[model samples]
Target chain A: MSEFLRFVSHQIEDFAMQVTFNPVEGTGTVVYNLSLVRVEDLEQTISVFRATCEAGVSPSSLIRILYAGEELDGFVIPQNFCGILTLCSTTLDGLLLQRGIPSNPIGGGVIEVAENIPKRFTHLIKYEYTTIDPLQVLVSQEITSVHQVMKHGNGSILGNIRECHMEAEDDVEEVLDELTEGYFTGILDLGLPNTPCLGVAVDPQYMGLAALGGTNWMAALREEGISVTMQAMKGLCDISTMEFVSQL
Target chain B: MSEFLRFVSHQIEDFAMQVTFNPVEGTGTVVYNLSLVRVEDLEQTISVFRATCEAGVSPSSLIRILYAGEELDGFVIPQNFCGILTLCSTTLDGLLLQRGIPSNPIGGGVIEVAENIPKRFTHLIKYEYTTIDPLQVLVSQEITSVHQVMKHGNGSILGNIRECHMEAEDDVEEVLDELTEGYFTGILDLGLPNTPCLGVAVDPQYMGLAALGGTNWMAALREEGISVTMQAMKGLCDISTMEFVSQL
Candidate 1:
């Protein structure tokens, strides 16, 4: 923990100011960049996660650490434990992959919403042609109006679209049902076979699906004038080590 | 025709320069904005069509005037004639309406293409929320790379998506088949029930369809440094008065 704090201090000066030794007060928070995790080095992953939390991307109340497969309630890493974490952008990809369903990551963009219903995508950048995560790019550019949507029920927010084979429709539905039952917040809309979702077109023989971007919260935080560091689809860590913000 | 010429001269100056009064050379070109046509006023529609053509939106050879319904091969309007002219954006809307298939115009966008195939949309704007036609907006902004698409089979071009009742699938397919048989260049893609046609989403129980925008030619011309004035979906006129560029 001291080493992690030292690392956070080296990376960001303000992180130390936000950290509180009291775990019960929830001032200590950790965010794992799901895309950046190195599974082979669980120790490094843990260190990075801790360092990020210490970096104070958000108030502890707003930090969200989710376990994908099974829920374990604790902040401490259990020895020999392994599990998956989910970010909204890559949650469905991970889920479908676990079920052996091939899914393709397509594009990420800003989805405009009105009265809490998605109206259309106002901007899009295709995944194939971009070097960075499109959502991250949009967020960093400060182009998203997520805070307005949250406050007024109308504005633009981050989302992503992807497609899977037509044959996986039933399986996809089943997964969606499970996610819904689990109260997942990532899903935005799913298209029929060969259809578009959220006004975006899909390839023939494939169905498009959209999810709220994982960095949406980060955008919202940034919109609120809070500083945040996000690593989207970073990598993996044991679910056992995660503590939900609510629990914290 | 003199009165129409007067109207055209008042609306644009260069249109007179392009009018060679040579039928064989195809210098006399007219484009009718299908949406702006007050069906009750056929003479006025003709006047507007002629005026727009005379405004020099395109070169004589590149001018395309499409008849939506039954074909009539003539450049003169039969007395008391009533017929439909199709712009790519309004063509499907008219066809589906004729068949009692309730269709909704959803959006207009710039679709990126690679190797003669659509990859994804780099930009989109929903129709329900905008006053101006999205394609026209994108084209007038000089943002489309249609010339590149035409020359290299990769670039961005104009397209629009719409949705219709799922029950109208057969009717829509029949219309598509007929259009295909007629060698239509407007049809871009069609989605399965409740799917998006080109990466745009549709409502539940509706299917999405997309067509190349009629303004695509204008964009291509503009990309090559041609200044073109466009009035998309402007109105309608008798199909008999239309002359295909090849026929001319």
Candidate 2:
């Protein structure tokens, strides 16, 4: 069981990971497969975990799933599918990477939002200097005002900054355009080459890109005094397999 | 004498620092006077150092003096004026500060120039991480292609980035406009609030400003194997007392 948990925690997207829990037998199976995830196994596991998903409850407020990515449309999954779920943030990162743009993570921070518009970052920690995910540290600190932002359209939420070389400027725009067409959200801003995006400085010859963090909705839950477990950037999965919370 | 040398090296602008070298006396006096500098003494010192001023020579290529600031109009003074010289870069910093804007030094870098136009930065060192001035380090590394830029309108030269809060954006713009009218030339770019200028990012709620370093010409000199000693941001001076290199 410990080994299975470890696999789930460290899983990456190219590989498929599946976990099944049976309270009656006090037994479970953890599969680390490189091929297509067995649909039967995933469906069965989803059913078991779905019982606790609280039909009609907001994914962020629900005790089980928080988001498949930053709270864009609030995707939720069964607890059993926790670590294998794909994140919208990483998916965007992946799409950019696939096009040969080297996206370098600059930092993560609490971005202040006014009238649902990201205004500026109130606190930041660079990814290069941290031992853990900076966003995770921030979310755990409970310093965010995501709840207020949601309720009043003014507050703070989690976000991150990344940079890509200016030479790929055209390609980046294309990717962003495609993502928008595909109904993707959470991208806060894209700066011009050699410019700070969302108030963060980027290195020379690179353009900064800021996005709302995938785990921001979880922060809202944590703010409301709910004990929730999150495995951020757990691993990659076929983005198609993930369903938007609205659809669920 | 060593003490005087140290004081010269560490001089700040608020205090009037004067040094008079007399080879005949085999000694020099370094004065750190907080009061207004006596004009008679300054004129006498200036005459003595003016011997090496090389009439009609570009201040950048002359061995005696570089600039009162960056090579904007190529201002040159005598070698005797080196340490006490004012810089266009710090002058802008001061103006911003006077307007209640805290201009935070971000980094020093080698900015690429194409067709006599500032393009992008090729290298950078954050000021926060270094004990020595980052520009001095880059200049000494002998990696700049400043000479090529000067000759062929393409190469690299030194520049720096500083940021000031967005709340004072109007004040900052006012200072910039005044400087431009006054023939100040070191400023390369000023970003909109929360944007990067000249390929460097600014902190949230702040705007990044990129300027040609006062010592950029020194980089050009260094590239040509001419040994140069630079006391960057050594001190401030009355802007009126200085003459444009072209005028000289």
| Least well predicted 10-residue stretch by lDDT in candidate 2 chain B | B1-10
Candidate 2, residues A130-183: lDDT per residue as tens digits?
Answer: 223445445555568776776677878888777889999888887766554323
Candidate 2 regions exceeding 4 Å error are A1-88, B1-248
Task: Rate residue B21 of model 1 by lDDT.
Answer: 25
* Deviation of model 2 at A1, angstroms: 34
DockQ of each model vs. true complex: 0.01, 0.01
Clashing pairs in 2: A12-A236, A13-A236, A70-A214, A196-B196, A201-B201, A201-B202, A202-B201, B13-B236, B70-B214
Q: Give lDDT tens digits, candidate 1, residues B101-180.
A: 87777666777788878765555655543333456546655557775776677878777777889998888887776654
Q: Report the Cα interface RMSD of each model, rounded to 1 decimal.
A: 19.3, 19.9
lDDT of residue A161 for candidate 2: 74
Question: What TM-score is obtained for chain B in each of the predicted models?
Answer: 0.65, 0.64
lDDT of 2 at A21: 18
Residues B1-248 of candidate 2: C-alpha lDDT, one tens digit per residue: 11111221122223212322121222332111011113334433233223212210111111123332333223334433332243435444545555567668676667777887887666665554332345544555555776576567777777877888888878777776655443344677788887667766677898888887656555545454444455455433334444444354
lDDT of 1 at B225: 51
Candidate 1 Cα misplacement greater than 4 A, ranges: A1-248, B1-31, B34-88
Residue B15 shift from truth in candidate 1, angstroms:
26
